[model samples]
Target: MTNPVLVEVVRSGFVESVHRGALVITAPDGSVRFFAGDVERPVYPRSSNKPLQAVGMLRAGLTIGDKELALGCGSHNGEPGHVEGALSMLARTGLTEDALACPPAFPLHEPSMLAVAAAGKRRAAMNCSGKHAAMLSTCAQLGWSTTDYVAANHPLQELIRATIADLTCEPIETVGVDGCGAPLFAFSLTGLARSFGRLVTAIGGPERRVADAVRAYPWQVAGTGREDTVLMRNVDGLLSKGGAEGVHSFALPDGTALALKIDDGAARARLPLLLATLRHLGIDPGDEAEALAHNVVLGGGKPVGELRVTAGLFG
Candidate 1:
């Protein structure tokens, strides 16, 4: 694969992180709709891989009765509503905080963590704990041990890796430790996009449950102040999932899959670039859509500065 050009940004007269990567858009029939540089290069699809992990839970005999299913696939904010839903998931399987495999901590976002602490709880406040809880429940149903479930060599990790490879139609070339310290698999942008495309098109199959869950509880997928949740909720039949660092993906109902990665791992540029790319591709996100595509800031509750991305980059 040819190396993608090193796109650079300058701030204060110094070059910064080369926010460079590729994206792929494919159709239901597996035809490429769009392609960009170095799309074949490998990447570790982080939290963006959540939906597929939920698929493994289903395959392991996890009967995720609607609500549990939604919470399982969500990268939820530790909001009261989201936590309540996650707790209900644990309740259904007669499991509790002690059963979760993910480490104990507060939500990733400060505001959400404050909200969670105000509610007088700690365990449920952990964002990925919901996913860990679902995994534990699945392990129980499968008669497997919950201990070391997050370890790379654990059966859960193996299942997750296998499932990701299966969906992406690529071999797992390497594994890395994710932010939550779980195993992360590497695959090409094309492969990642292909996996998501399949997920969206498989709306009537078993995968449909995940799609339904994300669509139904878009708010739970992320929370207030999160772009993934906002994008999904606002876009009709479009699912948005964000990974740690710079990974993000979106799939439209029309069978278009898009994936992107920012090399510098700058959280700020990700969503803005994604929103812009989707728009350039003719995906209309109507009403205040420019707010997403362009970087506009408020100073003391009033508009102040605007960050304008170059349009030529898209072409």
Candidate 2:
């Protein structure tokens, strides 16, 4: 394993917390150009792994438009559009929210959570609803069992697992349940970056379809003002997705890929670290990085300090 990178430091007038993590950048041909911290070890990619899973469903014969595809690959903000999209996916499959294996939960977006709670809606509005709905529809299309779709040993899950393996070009290490109840694999950070590279640079096929949907409907993939949304919308030919426990992944049109994880699970550190990583990659995010700095430290509701990448991150 390589040495860990000092990716970020939190400050409230002074250094408050430090985040140590690894980053792996791979070319389309699977050559590692930059390696930081333990890329050889397995990390739970969380929702950053969804695009590969979405393309997996595509190969499994799931049929839908760009909207559904975008939502299928998203960690949505649980906005009304997101909920409607999830419900619509279910509607097309002749199923209901009752079939979803994920426990009922509120929206990830605060305002939408308030509205959804007031309306007494739960499961269908959850952030993972679209992915759940996608899995259900894939089962419907493939004649697989929808009951216990989230189970680790389900045939549907096996296929999804195979897809991850196929894209990463590596065997699975271990399996665990995602926050949304779907079975997820422990994948190496280098493998994660390579898989994302494969997805974004894929030719005209299911992979391209997933990538195109993400680029075309960036909002559906996240939501208004969200980091992924902002980055995809404003940055040319950039694809970004963030996952729980401080996992972040992005890819370029040319198949440049980067995957990073914060050891402390600080979401605030992910973007700043990402911007610095991008700088190392020679891509300038320009004003978009500045615009997405909403995670600043607040003192009495006024901005006091900032979360930023530590110097010499690549050291």
Candidate 3:
């Protein structure tokens, strides 16, 4: 059982593509609400595991500021605000962008690039740089070597692996390379959800600062156009994180966890499905649901093309 959802792209009256995947929702008490396909099949958690990684950083005695905490869990858009925040984090620890291990790239938000270019900068401004920077800073704090920080054999990686295993309550049996060249682990969707649940639970138990930081600076945790930040903004006492290739996770303040993996990586369907699942679990997102349901891009405060979800898979 690979993907249970039928994904098709029919544009201009022709089916252009198709995909498959699964989604699972669970209650706070570990009861399943809805499940499709192999919900328990192991998969790479990807960037969705950032918040949980932040928990490891916290437990390692990293007293990061709210902004750093957010960066630890973020896939930031590399906007000026994001770069400034990352630089501030490095500055606080007597480090610089040169200390980061992530490859240089550009901002995820197009608007941010204009601002960054206008400032006469040479750095690529990639969003994930902040996460890499946080990793470097944590390694620095822990007396670990900055060289080979991204290597799977690094001490930091060992700590991260141990932390993830502890949170998921499942030993990692597979490892893959991530976009930033870091090692990614394979775990079931349920294991990822349970990992997040444990992270939320840990935040309340002696690691309250990590939770406080994520909640206090949700924007830095993802970016302006990211679902994690939007969901966090819309829901009270809930934290959300999105991963590459259509992976996502959300945790209720009380430890309820929801995780999803969209086989095709059609990001448009991710939030809507999550919203529907959350609603089924008694979560209300108000007007945010509209934004989640449709894409209304505004250039000059007027309507333009919209990104719509046309999936009939639920029916």
Q: Each prediction's Cα lDDT score?
A: 0.72, 0.84, 0.73
Pairs that clash in candidate 2: none
Query: Candidate 3 clash total?
Result: 1
Error of 1 at 97 (Å): 0.9
TM-score of predicted structure 3: 0.85
Which candidate number maximizes TM-score?
Answer: 2
The parts of candidate 3 lying over 4 Å away from their true place are 1-3, 6-19, 31-33, 118-124, 206-208, 293-315
Candidate 2 lDDT over 204-296, as tens digits, reads 888888888998999999887788888887778888889999899999989999999988887777888888887777777778666685548
Please, what is the TM-score per model?
0.86, 0.94, 0.85
Worst-scoring 10-residue span by lDDT in model 2: 4-13
What are the runs in model 1 whose C-alpha is more than 4 Å off? Answer: 1-18, 108-112, 115-121, 287-294, 297-305
Per-residue accuracy of model 1 over 241-306 as CA lDDT, tens digit each:
888777888788766888877676665667667776678767766555445544544558765554
Q: Of models 2 and 3, which has the larger TM-score?
A: 2
Q: Per-candidate RMSD vs. true structure?
A: 3.2, 1.7, 3.7
Candidate ranking under lDDT, highest first, comes to 2, 3, 1
Worst 10 residues of 3 by lDDT: 305-314
**lDDT of model 2, residue 267:** 78
Error of 3 at 136 (Å): 1.1
Note the clash tally of each candidate. Answer: 0, 0, 1
TM-score of 1: 0.86
